[model samples]
Target chain A: MDNNIIRFTYNVDGTDFTSAGQASVMLKKNLRQLGISPDTIRRASIAMYEGEINMVIHADGGVAEIEVSEECITIMLKDSGPGIKDINQAMQEGFSTAPDDVRSLGFGAGMGLPNMKRYSDHMEIESELGVGTTITMKINI
Target chain B: MKITTVKELLEAKVVWGEELIGKHVYSACGSDMMSDVLAYVKDQSVLLTGLVNSQVIRTAEMMDMVCIVFVRSKVPNQEMIELAKESGIVLLATDKRLYDACGILYSNGLCGNGVRRG
Candidate 1:
């Protein structure tokens, strides 16, 4: 726990798709108040947003924690649901297991993890078959 | 181009942010899939979509987009409108379809060539 690091924790609710992105929206506001760069804020916000949506769609919700430091911003998402069977396949663009209804809502397009990785400087995913999944992503400030 | 110009080009009805129409935008992208929008879009100030959801507003907010145009006359619900209002993102609805709305805006100088960054 560095003195300069600020942490935020949020509980993402999987029951409601309409409220899926609330965490990301809050993070964006908090980052702006901290006077972080807009690009950095956008990157962090977008990456976390995709993660938030994933948790709701696939993981039945999760806990998201964001830590801000002088070096970079780190996002940690943990979800308890059907874990991804193949991380590599899940990482591939256009490879989604989301139901058809999710697609109608403008998500579940198989771009979540890829988008998270694309926006962040670094990302790592850890998942177990029936246990859960944890994703860690970092964005350089 | 100005938001006013976008409104005119697409003949869009401002669902919200009428006062903000004076704002200017440089680039725009049209996508119903928020995934692709998050994946490839950069510095895109406007989003045109047929998808109606609060996530759409959240996606635009995440991208720092200032305006959203709902093509095919799709009306956003109250919750979505509130979210957009909170984010200060303008909302516009048009009777034109997605392709037609995008074509009009592109032909009117609102290019999709967003400034890319690595």
Candidate 2:
């Protein structure tokens, strides 16, 4: 049988934390309708949700592309912001650059990237200081 | 345990999803940190937390949790309740503290979704 492929693009708004996880929520619904396994959907949604939040908190905004096929689901998030100066530092838990106000909102614990890495089967990050950041994550179905 | 049983066990007030009380939940997690919840990957259906905010509901939705229990007498506002309702997640509030509530559930056969570290 030929594999079914689906693709979706989301425009993330970084200024509003209230609307950050909308993309992931919608993607979860779409995946459920497509009959993906609950575990696969949860991992994909959680990884993408963390990426979405990072885009809003660190970057001004960003773009998310999700491609779903029989073999795997791929997510690419690109943001134009003050790129990560130290990738190692950013990856560490409890090391966050977020302002105190962001922490009050229940995020900015420096666990976003780490959670994304934990949930996805594979992950890649590309960034440049003052330029932008791009993260690619994939989960095998 | 069923969501209804949780409500009864904790003497929780139902904030939303009254219809979902009969739903079964095999595992649960209690935490104030959204990132910690995201870090642990499990098929847990219930979340018990003291943190009151929109992210709590968002995290539960992202994880596909069926219900949220607000511990320590924390009451969620309309916005948070609305978000939970939209996600079809049952919301409950209890006077019990986080540790006590988790213990009650654990003793009643609710397992935690263990954390994964590498």
Candidate 3:
């Protein structure tokens, strides 16, 4: 395996709804500049964007770490917010705990986790109710 | 369809990314829900949406969309415009509602290839 890897890290700001997807936008740009395939880049960006938005809306903020190897790109999003009580329920489409205000902004549609899973080649979630949640996703390049 | 044609069809005002006006896009999806857009859209270059928040632009960016149409006279804030400009995604606002705007474009050759099929 080629080991020419690149890494990126972004601190998601949970305080502002307007800035929710900024990290994903930046990652997309960097991937494009690196000449990644559009399909792979799109998949990774969508998955990462949903995760980033979830961090803001649910977890109050988080840290995103990205590692790009020749064969795949991996994202690790970890947040210190109240952990998910029911991971299975949260993964279901059309199920959301978001308030009406989030709906008003045209999100909280309960499609984030599903879309994240749909777009990534591999996904893993680890959470503790009182602790935090860490979601790992990978898209093979 | 060429983006210029999309602009003409919607009678929209280009808010930014004038240089991208001549680019072409094949399909479009109109939705206010960014989450749904992210989930359903596949290979769409144009997004027609009513939402005016910054995430609208970010959603487009995540999908690698080249253009966004804000239907129903919705206007984006400065932050949204800047984000679009940075991504080189053309932004347009049309007085036509989402349905009408989509209808015009669909009839003119931009079909619903990117939208989720029932």
Candidate 4:
């Protein structure tokens, strides 16, 4: 069996709320070109998009790394923001620390992390209060 | 329902992608929170939102949604229009409130159960 992997990296800009989902959008197009199934593409893009939006809203942006293989797709999101204080609490639906303004922009309903988990086949989160946070998710193709 | 029917039922003005109105949409959902919208992406082809932003278009695009109805006559910005145009997602604006717009469509047979167009 040949083990081949394609990788793509995108810089999430924390300053701009409007451009948050750009990476996921581009990734969707790329995956389409690779002839990935629409269902898989939708799941991966939605999961990555939630992560990207969270990076901008909570972590002041970060780096998103995507790895695509024949069997699965892996997404790694790393951020250097204040970090998640309680992973369990943050994982709960509708539990949000995002301010009032973000809600007006049609996000921050506290569904980001949970939605990422819901769409992916597997998910993991690592965080330190003062240091940073990293989230890894995988979807089986 | 075809996207053109959604436009007529809501009395919506086309913001972009007027040429693509002949497309058909199976199911529909209405929400301002994009995350909530993302949670229910089960073949939902039409998105009704009052929230105006580029991510709105991007969300519809990610879901493979063919149309977005902007309730309450809320107009999307240039960036949003351009984004929808780029993705070939039709954008429509209506003066009706979210609930009424959704109700109208639901009463007319468009549903939220992710039904397939027959």
- Rank the models by DockQ, top first: 1, 2, 3, 4
Candidate 1 chain B weakest ten by summed lDDT: B109-118
- Among these predicted structures, which one has the highest DockQ? 1
lDDT of 2 by residue, A58-110 (tens): 99889999999899999999998999999988999889998888887888888
In terms of docking quality, how is candidate 2 classified?
medium
How far in Å is the alpha carbon of A8 misplaced in model 3? 1.6
TM-score of each: 0.97, 0.94, 0.94, 0.96
Two-chain DockQ for model 3: 0.64
Candidate 3, residues B5-116: lDDT per residue as tens digits?
9998899999887788999898898898998888876778899998898889888988889999999999999989988888899999999999999999989989877654
Local accuracy of candidate 1 as per-residue lDDT tens digits, B18-112? 99999999999999998878876667999999999998999999999999999988999999999999999999999999999998888888889
Candidate 3 C-alpha error for residue B85, in Å: 1.0
Cα lDDT of model 1 by residue, A7-29, tens digit: 99999999999899999999999
Off by over 4 Å in 4: A1-3, B114-118
Task: Give the lDDT ranking, best first.
Answer: 1, 4, 3, 2
Decoy 1 TM-score against native: 0.97
Off by over 4 Å in 3: A1-3, B115-118
Mark the regions of model 1 whose C-alpha exceeds 4 Å error after superposition: B115-118
Which candidate do you rate higher for TM-score, 2 or 4? 4
